[model samples]
Target: MQRVRTAPRHIAFETRPAGKPLDAEWTQITTREFADQVSAFAKGLIASGVRAGDTVMIMAPTQYLWAVVDHAALFAGAVVVPVYDTASPAQLQAIIADARPVLAFTGTAVHGERLAQAATASGTEAPQLRLLDPDPAIPNDASLAGLAELGTTVTDAQLEERRLAATLDDVATIVYTSGTTGDPKGALITHRNLVGQVLNTAAAYSEVVQETGNTVLFLPLTHVLGRALQLICIANGMRVAHLSDPKEVVQSLAILRPTFLVVVPRVLEKIEDAAANSAREKKVLPLWRAAHRAAVAWGVHLEAMDRDPGARAPLGLRLRHALFDRVFYGKLRAVMGGRIDYLLSGAATLRPELARFFRGIGVPVIEGYGLTETTAPLTGGRPGSLVAGSVGTPLPGNAVRIADSGEVLAKGVGVFAGYRNPVHTEQAFVDGYFRTGDLGSLAPDGTLTLRGRLKHVIVTSTGRTVSPESWEQTVEQHPLVAHAALVGTDRPYLTALVVIDTEAATAWFRDRGDAPARALTEDGLVVCADGRLTEEISAAIHRANAAVSPSERVQAWEAVVIGEDRASEFVTPTMKLKRQALLDEAASITDGLYR
Candidate 1:
């Protein structure tokens, strides 16, 4: 990739509205206006006693206010600590205490008040709190107007002073881990680290603009993927549209007609589900079946085409393209802007079957790997260089190596400075390389294949070290299981704590003449009106478990009802399991096996 010297001057760090004609097509915010808002918010923050280097916590959903508050804190030379919107009060309290923030910006009055109470309960130093709106009024308190009202016009002199004081080496943000595995730790990221990561990512996806012309942003901004993509968009001079609702994505695609997109495995799964259901509804029609088969066949052919550069296209390829374009490709494209040059998937592993299915439908799912600590996207499969099941080669300036124990080690300019806790910072690195804790191999073609996290490995008493993530992925692929965590560390056999997809489970029961007349509830089990495994449900679990090794097979399992009021059970923002909390609550079921 050629390095370009023409960097945009004046930083233009915030969203700027594209001039008229395109104005109504996007949410408009100019660079000057963005700077003024940041300056005003910084002044208000300073008056509230937030000093340089002090942490300012932000716990909010995706909104323009989130972007404003984050940039304001950075401009003020203060470190920003971003908290997930879905985090519980206790989780928020823990992070606030650990970071010892001076002030916090929350999404609503309810969460803001709850945070204050949680801090008091934890006996931690409570920071000054400002409520963002709870009543959902027009232009809520979290709106840009609300923040602008907090202070008067900031002078040019003041802006210059703040800008001059800011340094690239300074700690810009402290993003806490989602705590899916254990306690969350803040990953300390410097300005330079983030800037480098954006530059590197832009280089990899440069073809998206040169080839396709547009990109869409839908991931949560608090996470690394969203954060990094924001910077990449600015640096690449690309237009970005943010959508908070996943359901609105297809509609947005129709309007925006984005050429590229960043997505998670869950979103792709939904798309596949939609397509399959549509096909099933039209199955009775003979022409529908023929069209569907042709589309599926064409999808398979497209996947083959992707694999070989010089493969001759069969004459049937063109015929099917013309025949299936309206019924298949057109619908798929309508849901995805119909002109996407590439679709990038990360945060979790993409099932091989799903990847192939999408590739067959003409949308290439390029899987990548990274963490919050690496500012995301350490490795990505380039447009023409993609391989199934492997996160493509490391980005330029990033190095990847596998340890004897199979732990993946990464070293690069994009690597974060360290975790906020000094002890964790020291422990996370081994001989200067960041110990990713993830186990994976570097393939012969430079692609990276993730095995599982080292800490989550289940070591059987018989001496086999099995990665539950490997098995968990397969289990989750089952239609009934929404999410599954394979548990059984140091045990004879594994046991799964499964969260059944309530929608699919409901349909499964209905088809078997076992639909619940009313809701049935129980601990460690979900039942219809009649008490039983709902027929074939247990069989599905057994079949999923049967696919794994004997030691890794789930011996006993519990059904996780969707709306259960389990306080500490569920994944964190990054989608990692909260193992300690789950194990504690399920101790009775697990303890008997050890005895």
Candidate 2:
């Protein structure tokens, strides 16, 4: 509202039409235009009998209208529930039953049908359905245009009556957790929660936030961090755009030439992989490899100097870095639109080496940490304080304390009100601090370095404890090693169930005019029997093993190839590995290793 009043004509968003070419001109949506859309939609929602505290479901991709409906629903004194476009039927049914929205909105006819089916499957009354993007063929319920027609019956006074009834403490959204371990629980994010994050981020990164540079958001809007970052962008007067499909992100980054990006570790992995593949195809693989090494070296040098004031980068290292900056780093930056200064990563732990690699190439990857209960961001990397392995220092008002049980605890303005379920809420907090379930240690400088999840800590037969995440992340740095899960609970030695990335492995062989040897495991899954592939994987494991004790190192491992469906069962949509699920279901794969 303040933006509309102050700078009504300012461009708030830019979007390219679907099916448009990459070079096509983007359509601009201004602040006043967006604000008006919100007001009219809120009136329509009110006219359609939506009341204060009613849950309004918006199931769709990240786009302009998602922003409109989200704001409109909240403005009408209703709570908004964002559902990811890729949600499965089972997942849909579970959320629909729990949220019990009074009105549901979908961007496509297919999603509308899915919602209707899920509502039926859950045995819940179907909410009044509405289409976000109008389609003449879709039957049932009002479209956005049709909603405007209904708004004629609603008066300005009536809309204001419900809107004014909202309070800061009221639940704005019930964001469901990714549910890697168990059922998804709704974390109660209040209006205050969102505002608090925005304020703190703006304070911490004033120049980074307030700059007039544009950014493209590709993460799912259903993600709490995605939604919160959008708000922070608006608060800081940055022009924003959306790309619903993450696969198209590289092109969007080049097209938008964004000043910064917010993404998870997987996205960075993809970006690096894409660059490496392009280099391989162009026959510049060796040069690219050298550039990568130089960049990483520079990053390590920078971090050492930052930590120790008396330390300085050697002249030889600095000169070589400068050469790589011109010869290779510039082109790498061009792929990222040539203007990105910051790469804000969150949602999962980022590998330390990847952070160093990017930071060395003039793009500092600022890893941050938070959960749905923190409303997305509680800590973020600050300039001059970035530590490669640490997520960052706590934000302006948010602070974390380590519990005796190795859990990260927090209490702050951005802390969520509580969980939606009373039973879960009772177990969620201790002495006013929200239990973060993650285990971490804080650097002397206040930056936080996450070890792994508390529940994932491995206890071996000899009573030796191991943190499998660091090992898994390091081994996964190999493009061929898609996923790694360390196993050795109550066993003599640690073994692993490593999932081979068949696509990448096959491509590598094909590019080299060779083929991978193949065989079937006892459990019937395909295994790449090529010695080269095995050697490559063994080399990666060796690197990871070097960082661990003899007992914690993976002595033997089994390789199995998995497709998307099988992989989905073991990982959340965000690519977070479900350790227990993998160990339980794939127990047979590694059984032969122990014998």
TM-score of each: 0.85, 0.94
Whole-structure CA lDDT of model 2: 0.83
Candidate 2 worst ten-residue window by lDDT: 519-528
RMSD of each: 5.0, 2.6
**Global CA lDDT computed for model 1:** 0.70
Q: What are the per-residue Cα lDDT tens digits for candidate 2 across 1-595?
A: 7788788888889978777766699998888888888888899999899999999999998887888899889889999988876677888899999999999888887888899999999999888888876556555346887776677788888877877788889999999887777777888999889988888888888767764778898777888988998888876678889887777888877888999889889888877887889888889899888888888999998788776877878888788888888877888899899988788999998888899999999899888999989998888788777888788878877889889987889889889998879899989899999999899988677778888988788898888888789888888988887788888878888988777776677777777787554642223345455677788789889998998877778998876776555555667656677667677777777787888
TM-score of 1: 0.85
Candidate 2 has a TM-score of 0.94
How far in Å is the alpha carbon of 325 misplaced in model 2?
1.3
Task: Give lDDT per model, in order.
Answer: 0.70, 0.83
> Best TM-score goes to which candidate?
2
